[model samples]
Target: MILTELFREQLAYFKDINYAKEIEFLKGFEASEEEIKEFLEKISLQKD
Candidate 1:
């Protein structure tokens, strides 16, 4: 779960920014589009 935790932490840090920017930032780390989608889904599930 460490990767998920890290993703969540980064997500929180960028919470105020646009979603597109978030995806760009993650892509800078070489994250694929599918990975970004999955990460967002996981974070949303955690919020529920």
Candidate 2:
């Protein structure tokens, strides 16, 4: 899928999970995985 659409998918997924730290535990990310990882990373990092 297009990167934009992938990002949108990530953004749309913003609310379903309650914990951001959990996303960072994933690895071997290629495309959409970063969107999710980074999104949650942003959330987790921002709390500091």
Candidate 3:
């Protein structure tokens, strides 16, 4: 898969598991809580 797709997959998995590393990684991206939530929602919709 492309890098962007791979990232989103990993993000969705980590977020689902509430993994600590996910928080640190997202912080590296300077992602806000709202942005994270929005991304999760989008991925979840695609899954359904």
Candidate 4:
């Protein structure tokens, strides 16, 4: 249980890092909220 909790914490941390990177990349493109949402949706669809 303790290991599971630790893993979840680390996973969340990495997710935050990735999310920040995505936002930074989007900012470079001057993406609006709708554009970002579309981009993320495309990514999620591709992942599946």
Candidate 5:
């Protein structure tokens, strides 16, 4: 699986358990503009 997919899976787990602090922690994870864009795209695909 791709790195983006990995992050997507993690995002889902936190979202499922209502982990607000985890979400904040994740938000703090610094990524490049390209990485952020790619990660968001993967997350969007998972939502469908």
Candidate 6:
């Protein structure tokens, strides 16, 4: 799956489980740690 689609699915999974932290979900992606962090930072910013 594409990065954005995967990210959205992960976010849905976390929401379903009421997860407070997203780092673990981000780790599930096939991306480098830095890339995951950058993506997470972007998502967080968009939420604010």
Better of 5 and 6 by lDDT: 5
**For each candidate, how many residue pairs have backbone atoms clashing (under 3 Å)?**
0, 0, 0, 0, 0, 0
Report the Cα lDDT for candidate 3: 0.62
Alpha-carbon lDDT, every model: 0.60, 0.55, 0.62, 0.49, 0.56, 0.52
User: By how many angstroms RMSD does model 2 differ from the true structure?
Assistant: 10.6
lDDT of 5: 0.56
* After superposition, candidate 6 runs with Cα above 4 Å error: 1-29
Candidate 3 lowest-lDDT run of ten: 13-22
Give candidates' CA RMSD values in order: 7.9, 10.6, 6.6, 8.8, 8.3, 9.7
Rate residue 27 of model 4 by lDDT.
Answer: 42
TM-score of candidate 6 relative to the true fold: 0.35
Clashes of 1: 0
Please provide, for model 1 over 1-48, each residue's C-alpha lDDT reduced to its tens digit, 9 standing for 90 to 100: 877666665653434656555434554578776687677666745731
Please report the TM-score between candidate 2 and the true structure.
Answer: 0.30
Clashing pairs in 3: none
Ranked candidates, highest lDDT first: 3, 1, 5, 2, 6, 4
lDDT of 6 by residue, 1-48 (tens): 366666654542332454366544454565665675567656644531
Among residues 3 or more apart in sequence or in different chains, the pairs in candidate 2 whose N, CA or C atoms overlap within 3 Å are none
Q: Candidate 2, residues 18-42: lDDT per residue as tens digits?
A: 7556444446654466576787656
TM-score of each candidate? 0.39, 0.30, 0.40, 0.38, 0.35, 0.35
Candidate 5 lDDT, tens digit per residue, 1-48? Answer: 587666666653333444345223365676664575566666746832
- Whichever of 3 and 6 has more TM-score, that candidate is 3
Q: How close is candidate 4 to the true structure, as a TM-score?
A: 0.38
Clashing pairs in 6: none
Q: Which segments of model 4 are wrong by more than 4 Å?
A: 1-28
